[model samples]
Target: MTLHEDACRVLKEWRAPDGAQARLRDTYLAHLDAYGDGVWRSRREGHITASALVADPARRRVLLTLHPKVGLWLQTGGHCEPGDATLADAALREAVEESGIAGLELLPEPVWLDRHDVRCGGPDAWSVHFDVEYLAVAAPDAAERISAESLDLRWFPYDALPDRTDDAVRALVARAAAALG
Candidate 1:
């Protein structure tokens, strides 16, 4: 199969029950195809980013952020902005900037690629269809610091994740647990 077909195939497997996943995959695939075109290319393109599954070794817990929007606990990440040449760098940068944790390490080499839409400044501002979400490991000491993007950040054991957390966040926790084993 061609690269696009291959990517689409994988996306099919990564598919979730929600229609959102299909939208994300379709949008990002288009971005990938139009990567070299001018002008609107940069703006329309989606970029990669990392989300740190920070763990507190001492406490045997994982660190999570309570996002300002969506209001559920999740991993920190944002767009891979103009300065980031690669998605991996963007992932790491956003993790640090949003999570207030330094020394994060991209782990499992970002085993997944997915897309999501980020609505900006209410309905009127620019909306971003982010070709995003890389998975990573933090330097174990990350639980000590928390950034402003989160209303609260803290460590929670795998078995003790808050009930209010989103399903996607829970899926990440499951993935992390499997990787560590």
Candidate 2:
């Protein structure tokens, strides 16, 4: 199946946690229905993005990247690429690319859905990211390297994440921690 088809299939089968997630899921489905692959880029009014919360095998720490453009300490993720076979694959790819960590394994299902606005350079002043986030466990000996997409990459204790991290990130970490248990 095509990437758009695969994304639709994945979202249709995914079990969202609450009304907010359900709404985001529905919004993403609608976006796909309307825009197909165009929803993968910022050229559109909004797009679907995939992210992963990378946790250690013991779930005591998580890897977070300081996004250069957004300047926020957030999960590893980005715009879906044409080569991406599935949403989960996109999330995994982003995690590896941003964290430069090997042997990261994604959980079978997504852990969170978030919709946030972003500023893009073109005619559209801003775009919304319908973000799908997954939980991934890094290898026991996973070592991280900084990538061009990020200013820095670091492993933060689950209980002592950076102060700049937001509540949504904290929630994703909490959910990932529980899933790891």
Best-fitting candidate, measured by TM-score? 2
Off by over 4 Å in 2: 122-124
* Residue pairs clashing, model 1: 49-91, 50-91
Clashes of each: 2, 0
Cα distance off (Å), candidate 2, residue 73:
0.5
Q: TM-score per candidate, in order?
A: 0.68, 0.93
Error of 2 at 161 (Å): 1.4
Clashing pairs in 2: none
lDDT of 2 by residue, 1-181 (tens): 8878877888899988788788889988998898866447854688888999999957489999998877789999988898888889999999999898878899878999888888766555788888889998887788898899998899998889998888889989888887787
The weakest ten consecutive residues by lDDT in model 2 span 36-45
- Candidate 2 yields a Cα-based lDDT of 0.86
| Candidate 1 lDDT, 1-21, residue by residue in tens | 433333334444554434655
